[model samples]
Target: MNTLIKQFTLFVVLTLFTGMAAVAQQSDYQIQQDFRTEYNELLERIDQATTTEALEEIEEAINDLEDEYEQHADLIDASSNPDSFDGAISTLRQTHASAVESISTIEDLNDQIEDLETEMEGVKSRLDQLSDERTTLQQQIDASTENEARQASLIRQYRENIEERNLFVSNFLGELLSKYQSMDSAQQQEISEAAGRLEENPIDVIKNVINEYINMMDQSSALMAPDYVSMKAQHGYFVEVWDSIGEQLVNTFAPENPAQTQEEVDQLLTAWQSSITNNLWGSIRTSFSENGVELAEFNSSEEFFNALNSYLDGSIETSVERNSEEDYDVYREFNNFWSNTVKAEWGEMFIEGDILSQSQISAIDMKLDDWRDEAMPTSNLTFILLIVSIAVIIGLIVLLLTRKSGESKA
Candidate 1:
């Protein structure tokens, strides 16, 4: 029994030594079996590391139980006090707590570093966005600059057009001023007033005003057409009367002077208008009164009437005055009586001779002198105004469209 007790005590000593080896190897199960034997040694060594560096190193060693703890976070939690290394583990808790307090002071600084890195990523993203914005802005600016160039070109064209139109204004205004000087001063003032309420183009307005005057004069010139018509009617009356008289006289007096060719007679008749208007005032008055009316008065000589009457009786004496509008009063009286009388005489001659068939003579058309000269016309100003107004409206719309596009980009 004594030998057995000695053997058992030896076995216990060996087991204790083996447990010490396991403790060095960080074996929790082995350390548990013989903790009583190794506990004092662990405590002595733990106190030996008293300096801060030595404590810190020991704390590193203990806290660097990182690998072990990682494998057993739940097993080694503060509430996970293992019965095997309870006292040693308890001693380590105090040291680790002190280290934790020191590390807590650096936590805010470390978090700040992480936040700064995150903010840098955000800043990079914003920088990228800014770069894109800058590129888009550059494109917009380039387009706007091109538009400015186009607008500048338009301005240059406008200035050039202004210069060109000034020439028209120069002539129109000069003529108008000269005309105005001759007119009543009140008339001139009225014209100036008429020019005031205008904007588009003053030169064009002046030109349009002059064109209106010219057109008005052209329209009024139609009234002179009556003189031509009356003269023409008298021409017809003289032609029918003289042709009949000449054919009868020639046939009776000179039967062998066979009817002249159509061409020769046409030539002879062509000269009649100039002939009689120049002469034959008395005969014309007699013929006109016989038809229906009378001449107003005789400003012309009897020689004039004789020459014309002699021509109607088949004599051609070309010596005659060129009666101008200076002779208007004399001609006007003759024309006033002849206007009705000659037309009536020509109608009677047509009825008696039946030179032209009724259908042909009756179909003869009479047109107003306005066809030859208009009374009032559709004005050119209206068309020009329409074109200019459309251009201005289109230009304004394009400008507005470009502005809206630019504003949206901004």
Candidate 2:
């Protein structure tokens, strides 16, 4: 029994010793595996680092791993074979040596890289300057190649424009001279004054002269138109001017404002209306004398009407024997003569010539329409005045007759 008990105790001690050895060996292998993995990872970090700063960061991690490896040195040495610990220690020593060697060369390598970059920048700047100079030289060559053709084209255009202007001036000046001879004193003075302002530009001077002359002829023609015969006679006076000028004045220059042009001509006609009145009234008096009805000399429109009324009354009383006041209505006859002969002659002129275009005819019609519209209000006021005058005159006659009858009776 004693011997069996001894054998049991010995077996138990051997089993415990073998287990402790196996545990220590396993711990050492684990540490070796961990160290190998960490060392490999740090080496990979160092190889991947591009900058000196990044390489220094890996160097810090390596120093930390090395401190931890030394702290576990006794356990590794006691628990495992010397070969296992030696392999890890040698790997750490070689890695430290390589890191120190790499750190020593870093500053010089960075300086060399910076110098190369500076040299490349200078080369790039010089190449850019040379490229700019080449571009400038090419541009100068192209401009020199095109200069002769561009100059020739400009000269050709200049000559053509000068020739066209000369031809226009020549034709216009000829027509202007011929028309100047036929213009009245007022028209000549107006054109000469306008032309004097444009001495620097002969073309414009002649254009203004032609424009003024045409405006006068148009006004004269319009004012004389209600009497077609008189209008035709007036137009005939300027027929040569019309033939020479043709539609050149209107066709060459666009009227700035057609309505304004008509207004100006109307104003001019008003200023020159004395000549028209003399022409018309002189013709009337001459015809009346030819008809053997002697008229009293009259200057005013009112006196002229009174002389006409006296002629009509005397002529009617001698020729037609009438008993009633209505039969001897001399005023009505005067009104008829004024409305049918004089007013009708003064109203609208019928345009019937090739010299005036449709546009000009329409403009004339518009002017006449405007004048008639403006005159309508005045004509109504004039009629009202005539009525009031007649009523006052009748009342005065009645009052005089009543006073005369009362005095006779007394």
Candidate 3:
């Protein structure tokens, strides 16, 4: 009994000591593997902040860390007990693989983002250039439109100046020509030779000729009383009156008197030509004197056009005189008839046989009526013939039908 008790107590003591040792152990198959798994997970998290500053850094880290984790995972096995250590290691390895693969995918996405940003910057530059070009083209279009309007205005002014200067030259020279022509043939030949020698500086010639006329006017005025009209005085008087009537015309086109630009002079001349042709000289001059230049009131634009047409027609008439006299006579008779008819019609329509305020449209209506009258004779004849032809056709059809019906009945 004493030996069995001692053996049982020894066995119990050994078992308790073994249990305590097992509980105190830092590394046993299951415990060592749990510590390793926890330590590896902490290491993976710490290493996740890659020190290398590139997308490729994560790729390298994934390969290196995944290999290390798998090797560590192999240390725990299916043969191990308690903690099912092999399963834990397998789960940890799979997590490591997933993390590594996720990092690689993220790195690829980041690289693609960088390439797209770079391409976007290039596109932005081209868009900026297109915007700049569009602005430049719009500015050029505006500048061109302004330049064209300015050029048109300048051209119009230039034309008017030329006309005025030419008119002044023509009148002054015409006076001299008339005087020279009155002389004997031998003296006239001498005058012509002298004129041919004068150089054609239009401005110089204009100044010289106008000054001469001015001097001639001064001498004549000095010789005569204000009310007295001598032969020389009469000529000067008419020139003075004409000059008085020309003030508005002169002022309308008068550039700075001390020095006129070439373009201005040219345009003044053009205005003068139109003014002279339209017989608006006195009216234009009076308006200019009153400091009121309403060119629209003159409405001489039509008169100017009509004068040009008349001059052209006169030349054509001369040519027509050489052709068949019969045709010429026919044309003449037609012209006379048309003119008389128009004058008679216009007088009756607008005047109310005397005086009436006619509208612009009413005037046009009057002209249209006259034009219609011209065509009425021919139209009336055609209308009559058409009615007769239609009636004859209808009569023939009726006769034929009646005759056929009568024969059929017989």
Candidate 2 per-residue lDDT over residues 1-410, each given as its tens digit: 99999999999999999999999888878987787678778777766665667767776776787688887766666653544545655665576567657655655545644553454344435434533443444344345545876644544443333334334434544545464445455543333333322212222343343343343333321122223224233433334443444333322222344355434434443433444444545555654455444788865445655675565546445433433344334334544444555445432321231223345435434443333333334445588889999999999999999999999999
Model 2 alpha-carbon miss at residue 209, Å: 71
RMSD per candidate (Å) reads 45.2, 34.2, 31.9
Clashes of each: 3, 0, 20
For each candidate, what TM-score against the reference?
0.18, 0.25, 0.24
Q: Which residue pairs clash within candidate 1?
A: 280-304, 280-305, 281-305
Best-to-worst ranking by TM-score:
2, 3, 1
Please list the C-alpha lDDT of all candidates, in the order they appear: 0.42, 0.49, 0.42
lDDT of 3 at 364: 37
- By summed lDDT, which 10 consecutive residues of candidate 3 come out lowest? 221-230
Q: In candidate 2, list every pair of residues with a backbone clash.
A: none
Estimate, for each residue in 1-410, the C-alpha lDDT of model 1 and write its tens digit.
Answer: 99999999999999999999977656553333334334344445456653445555666565544333445433334333443344455566674556555444345434534553454344435434533443444344445555876645544443333233334334434443443334444433333333323232222332243332232223221112222233334346435544434333233223344265333444555654444343334444455556443435442434423333342222111111322333333334434443454445444443333322344333321111111112112243357679999999999999999999999999
Model 3 C-alpha lDDT per residue in residues 1-410, reported as the tens digit of each score: 99999999999999999988987653445545555666465446635743224324444544554455454454444434343445544554565556656666555545644553454344435434433443444344445555877645544443333334334444654543443334454433333333323333223333343343333333221111111112222233334433442332222223234135344434434443343333323333343234321222333434423432443344345434444444344344433433453234333432321122244325534443343333334445478889999999999999999999999999
